[model samples]
Target: MGLVELAFSDWIGTITLNNPKKLNALSEELIKDFCDALEELKRQSVRVVILRAPAGSKIFSAGHDMRELPLDGRDPLTYTDPLRLAVRTIEYFPAPIIAMVEGSVWGGACELVLSCDIIIAAEDVTFAITPAKIGVPYNISGVQNLIITGGTHICKEMLFAAQPFPVKRLVDAEIVNRAVPIDQLETVAQTLAEQISKNSPLVISLLKEEIRLLSTSHNLSPETFERVQSMRRSVYDSDDYQEGIKAFFEKRPPIFKGK
Candidate 1:
């Protein structure tokens, strides 16, 4: 079976992550398949695309496939990174994308869902951004994605603590549109997509582009930009960053010395 599967109903398209064995981790291959699926949906002019997993999944996605991460001193989330590509594809996709989230989302997967236009989640679902836990310094754009949803305070909390938060917290913060029973997840997403499909797709597409441009709009001095890059570079080049990946492979907690 394909790692990513596409199904359609009228003007709506659904992309299901089929690699439950890997907890649907956003590996390089899976991301490639996902991007291909989106391209196919775009060709079909799907008015709304639903990104989801199969029913009753206890862990929607484990986020970035750490095994694919480089052990050498190199940036893992570069422009050509798989997770980065997936997030950009979703954000720039003309159609309104809906994240049908069930179970728990972790690390880069949390950023992926937030990239979608609408998110319908299960009540028991959880969300967490865990770069800190693994000693990874998240990319600036991904950090901005969290701040866009709930401001700097929420962004700091999730990134610093790296703990799982119940779905209600996200709903209260307006990050998630709704948290319904597990059984209602599909129904809610379908209804929402149907409503979206009935509207003017052209207008929606324009608005989506406008929102993307506006939200990401910011003026930064060249020095400030270079400083940020240097800071991230310091971490990725440190021994702690290397230890983080090593610990994951060893199934042990990383012994970080803040190098």
Candidate 2:
């Protein structure tokens, strides 16, 4: 079926990214389905939400649908970007949204996972923040999201290096709550979700919002905001950016010219 699947049992809601053919890429349609699932779960008063992929998924998500990315002349990850919308939806969800990760998470998908209240991952899962690899100028808000979850130094490593890091190590960094063996991932995530569902939903919701507010309260002055935007604009407008996208489709290493 659907690119995203929703299920509810015992007050715990499950939202599965079901587009395995595309590695659950966050296309506009997929994000729309995901948000709708979250909304319906909210309406049904599901006490806790588990956002995941199907069991044993090899790639939890391939991140943003590169095909949907705008070419130069427009900001790619704008306010209304599907990836941004999905991250915001999870951040503002009344219930605690837990990311139950079982495979490699890349690019915008990692941002979505960080927006979740708790992250439980399989030991073999790896996360890569890859805008740099493709020469995309990542947005400031997205970068801040990564900093909040992973701290600045680690975020720098992830973004600059454009490489995947083991979920097991991220657990020690507090990015992930637990990194259990793949065999134990389902049990661990389910137990955590059920435990959260057992809590006072009202109080938990209040706390979730409060924590979300405080954690994401980074305020940038107008001048600072403009500077960040200008830098991102320059990157996206450069020849290197176009070359990167082209190379991706051609399945070859991009030959970036420092334009």
Candidate 3:
């Protein structure tokens, strides 16, 4: 079976993590498939992407697959490395990406949502990060995305305590864009996406960049700047940038390939 279920309609691409029997945990194959799917969506000019879990399950994800983790005694970075790439793909995706959290999210699952541009959650959803409890360092790159997009204090408390925060707290902390009744979560995200898609994709990307630049410390120390620059250079030089410019002059919606 496909590790992820991808469907597109009305310019919206929906991706559901389908390993529900495993609580939708992220495995090497899942991460690879997810990244590949997002890359394909980037090529297809999909205006928006919604990430969700399978039906009859509220647990969006429980994080990494401990059983599948590499046990060759090699550096664990191998696993985290690929996962980080997946998270970055979500972060720099030109089009708007939304997290539709209809259930529980924990560990790397939380990290994934934190990467999205917006998060819409079910009212009763539980959001937690349990890395500390597992004795693993919460060193994901998306942690900064969480803190900057969410809140500094909120990030600190969550990381330090590694506990699940209620959906209401997630909304209050601004981690999630909004929290609605379970039945309304999808509607909320779709509404938000529809509103976003009406605007010029070129402008949306520029606005995202301008906001990200201001919100992020792009001018940190020289070393840090290099790191951030390295992380984002591909986006700057992507085909989407070229299409955006062409679309502006042509007075039409540009199809971005995310090259």
Candidate 4:
């Protein structure tokens, strides 16, 4: 069976991450399937798309499949990486995409949720960007998404602490549109999707594109961009980076030395 599944009805398309055993880790194959599913749903003229994990799963996603990560010094989240492509696809999708978040959203998955047009999370939901824990240097686009949603203060705290922020805090930070009881999450998300699907598809599509463009309007100079990239490169090339990933697999705390 595919790691991702898509179902459509009444102009609303639902995509469920189906790898409960792996906590829906965004493996390369799964990401490709997800992108393909989005493309198919767009072709069907679905007015709204809902992304979620399979029901009854405790983790919405544990983020990227760490086992797939490279220890050979390549950037895992480079622009052309599968995870980056998946986020880009969601961001530019012609129709609105809503993230129906439950359980915990971690690392790259948090960026994925941030890229969605709207996010409705359950009360039990917790969002964490965990690259700091693994010494991974998060990409600029991902960080921008967080800043756009939650402002610089919230984004800085999330990235530096590498801790989960509860749904209520996210709602306050404007990252989450609403936080509903766990039992009511599905119903609320479905109702919202139905309402969105009733709107004119063309208008919705144009509005989505306008908002995406406007949000990304700020441009960084070439030299500044290269400087940021260089800083990130230094982190990924450091001994701390190796120790972080090693400690993760060894099930221990990483002791990072500023070397």
- Over all chains combined, what TM-score does candidate 4 have? 0.98
Q: Please, what are the lDDT tens digits per residue for candidate 2 over residues 82-191?
A: 98898889888899988999889988999999889999898889999899889899998899899988999999999999999988779989888988888998888899
The sequence of per-residue lDDT tens digits that candidate 4 reaches over residues 1-259 is: 2989999999999999998888898899889989999999989999999999988778999998988877888876798877789889998899999999887999889988888999999998899899988888888878888888789999999999999999899898777999999899999999999999988989999999999889889998999999999998898888998898899899999999965
Q: Write the per-residue lDDT of candidate 3 for residues 102-181, one digit (tens) a residue.
A: 77998878888888888888888887876444433334355666777667788888877878899898777666888888
Off-target runs (Cα >4 Å) in candidate 1 are: none
What's each prediction's TM-score? 0.97, 0.98, 0.79, 0.98
Candidate 3 lDDT trough over 10 residues, lowest sum: 70-79
Per-candidate RMSD vs. true structure?
1.0, 1.0, 14.6, 1.0
- lDDT of candidates 1 onward, in order: 0.91, 0.91, 0.74, 0.89
What is the descending lDDT order? Answer: 1, 2, 4, 3
For candidate 1, what is the lDDT? 0.91
Name the better of 3 and 4 by lDDT.
4
- TM-score comparison, 1 vs 3, better candidate: 1
Candidate 2 Cα misplacement greater than 4 A, ranges: none
lDDT of 1 by residue, 88-137 (tens): 99999999999999879999999999999999999999998999989888
Worst 10 residues of 4 by lDDT: 74-83
